[model samples]
Target: MDPSFRVLLVCTGNICRSAFAERLGRAWVDETLGEGASRLQLSSAGTRAVVGSGMHPDTALVLAGYGADSGNFRARQLTADHLADADLVLTMTRAHRRDVLSLAPRGLGRTFTLREAGALLDFVDGGSERGEGDHAARARGLVAALAEARSRRPAAGDDDVPDPINQPLETHSEAGQLIVDALLPLLRRLAGAS
Candidate 1:
């Protein structure tokens, strides 16, 4: 009986970045585990969500470009329950990360900015695609490895996934592109295909 690794993505408004992360993340999880996506659940929430809003139109377009669908996607507010249930909490920005941590101080070791988490993935060794059991072990190891890496590294400048709400479609597109690029490497490692 393997542990279910729950991953929660957080942003200011769930309509744009978080939804996009959720869609992209699920795809990666599927790519990594195929029918075993249940082994690695992916979801999203916002620090200040509109509660029931659909993804931004541009967000949908970007996801569509990546061959992922955003059909009927709705926003949800971040909650302590979400944090308590997660093994990894990836936020769109340091502020979102801070907010999530504020809500659940215990989650500090599990939460990270998407970029930060992915960037740290590059430094961990032995997370290669050896076997399912190995990949799962590596994935869990990677999370803990990241916590250790975070401790030794000096914090950098703000690395936020730009908010696309209330902005122009072009801005949304750019923001979406940014999110995709930032998460690609992290997602690849998570996919266990790297």
Candidate 2:
């Protein structure tokens, strides 16, 4: 059997975005990679909030809309152990990236934001004109550009998947759609990663 590719999806709370990403990413891996899917480990975590609950209602609804099951998901806190074990860590936002890196084990270099990874995949697939050297260098450039762009943006509200801890059900569903949109391509790339 081939070695499993361990992936960790992260967000501020485990109940929403990260959970959606994890489930979708797993399905993508299964569909695209097939037998290789058994060699892939996909999971989600939160920097804070919803540490022990199932996915938020809205997250479930949006995923259900797309025919993805949310039945096996549960919230978990981000931990150093998760970082240590992951071959790749994909976070939702820049803030979530910082939080995960802060807790990441030393010398661990396989972490990135979902957008950043998407950008790198674009670069690799010839969607962008950038020439690649090392994957690390390419990943860093992608992340830096994303962080710079994020700094100049306005804060995202319910449209941004606001924690959803006390928010309305509609909010969680909105957040789930946002997450699914962001995850689709990244999942495709990871599936193609050999």
Candidate 3:
């Protein structure tokens, strides 16, 4: 059996975007992969973390609205080891991507902004057979496809998931929706969903 595929999500405070992604992504993994969910490992961190802090209240509320929870999450600082261990590094912004690469230059091939990854989905082959029973394989292939697409194309437009901290609930909802917009397609593809 192959080792589990690891994914690291990076953001500024760890209490908002990244934490929401981690929880929502994990929920998707659990729902889609079922018994095979163990093959995927999801985690998150922050470039400027409030170490040991809980998820931002608004972020938690937004996540809860999506049927995911972050009640047990605690903010942690990003480290090179975290980057080294991940098969994919997804950042909330271009600045966070730069921060990740600065710490682990070798991660360049596997790193991309969350919005960028969503946009790159257009570049992956869509006709391949979906391995419904082996999402791990599908996910691995998807990652490779995204990396290749990353090389073939240059970034376009603003790809940031705006920071919603200290903002209104509507702002938080907008941010969460942006995350869902970028992430749900990937999750569906991973699950072989139409």
For 79-172, candidate 1 gives per-residue lDDT tens digits of 9998988878999989898899899998888889987876676566644433345445656666777787876665767577778878887887
Error of 3 at 22 (Å): 0.4
TM-score of each: 0.87, 0.72, 0.89
Candidate 2's residue-wise lDDT over 64-100, tens digit each?
A: 7777888867798888988877767787777787787
In candidate 3, where is summed lDDT lowest over 10 consecutive residues? 127-136
For model 2, which pairs clash?
A: 4-39
lDDT of 3 by residue, 73-161 (tens): 99999999999888789999999999999999988878989999889888888743254535456666677778888767775889999
Per-residue lDDT, model 2, residue 86, is 73
Clashing residue pairs in candidate 1, if any? none
lDDT of 1 at 32: 66
Residue 24 miss distance in model 2 (angstroms): 1.8
> Which order, best to worst by TM-score?
3, 1, 2
Q: How well does candidate 2 match the true structure, expressed as C-alpha RMSD? A: 5.4
Question: Candidate 1 or 2, higher TM-score?
Answer: 1
